[model samples]
Target: MPFGDFQKSSKDIQLLSEHILAAECEVPGSGYNHSEMDLDNCLGDDNGNFQWGGRNFHSHAHNIIFHPDEGVAHVPVLRADLDGGSKQSNVNLGERIGNVNGHLVFRW
Candidate 1:
């Protein structure tokens, strides 16, 4: 996680930023997987500097298929946005599920 030192806010006029280099997870037993890779930079004198980096791959699919007995879970989050080389905004969160003792918060 690198890139967390740029703070300038005046009610948001394009200087918003975020930084996180790596986040990892893995829990076996047929479900639980996580990942986060980020380096998002947005600066605007007129949207001049726009450096984007992103990778968020998440998974949690227990006993699938509409509550098959005592299981029916979902969490399929995937995002990929890799900067100027180009690979913009790819998202898939189906219904947004996966919070096994969740705690990953960063604010600046």
Candidate 2:
């Protein structure tokens, strides 16, 4: 397949995962105890934001952040683990850097 198609498909999948994960995160205490679903393995935010990410449990794990429109997409990734758990820790840095949402400057 062409690289463009591949990239689009990847983003599509990312979006889908984000949707499911985001919904799951919304319901309090609705995950962990189930047999069909495993919430512990996911990387998500409790704030119910539309953004979420994750990766496989490997020997070594690093950050994998993807804001989609963000220029770098995933920054400070030490390895290609395909997960954003590590990157979650650095979100404050971005906030410190600043998030210009219309007239609101979401910053520390």
Candidate 3:
């Protein structure tokens, strides 16, 4: 079979796992929770806003089931959820982080 045809055929009969992970740098000593910052705080007294400096981290996992007989090449039927938290500085100027949890489900 041609390379393209072989590739296509292989894709048609496999269960695949896909994952994405990302992270950013946090502001030094800026320990803040997402819920604590509001419009007022974000927008400083001078209307100059102080944006959240903490890095946002995210991850996603997917399980793709392929069914060639049904004419469906791939179907993503599994997922994972994630959550996280942190703590502020001793001076109370920063914010606090919280807990993180994740849930995974697979559809058979």
* lDDT for each residue of candidate 1 in 1-108, tens digit (9 for 90 to 100): 122211110011110122332232323344333433232321111122121221221111111121111214322222333333233333222222122322122332
Error of 2 at 38 (Å): 16
Off by over 4 Å in 3: 7-12, 16-63, 70-108
**Model 1 poorest 10 in a row by lDDT:** 7-16
Better of 1 and 3 by lDDT: 1
**Candidate ranking (TM-score, best to worst):** 2, 1, 3
Clashing pairs in 3: 31-95, 85-98, 86-97, 86-98, 87-97
Residue pairs of candidate 2 with colliding backbone atoms: 54-83
- Each prediction's whole-model lDDT (CA): 0.23, 0.24, 0.20
Cα lDDT of model 3 by residue, 63-94, tens digit = 21223223253321212222321221110111
Q: What is the Cα-based TM-score of model 1? A: 0.18
Candidate order by decreasing lDDT: 2, 1, 3
Question: Residue pairs in steric clash, candidate 1?
Answer: 1-21
Of the candidates shown, which would achieve the greatest lDDT relative to the real structure? 2
Provide the lowest-lDDT 10-residue window in model 2.
Answer: 18-27
lDDT of 3: 0.20
Task: Identify the candidate with maximal TM-score.
Answer: 2
C-alpha RMSD for every candidate: 16.7, 16.6, 21.8
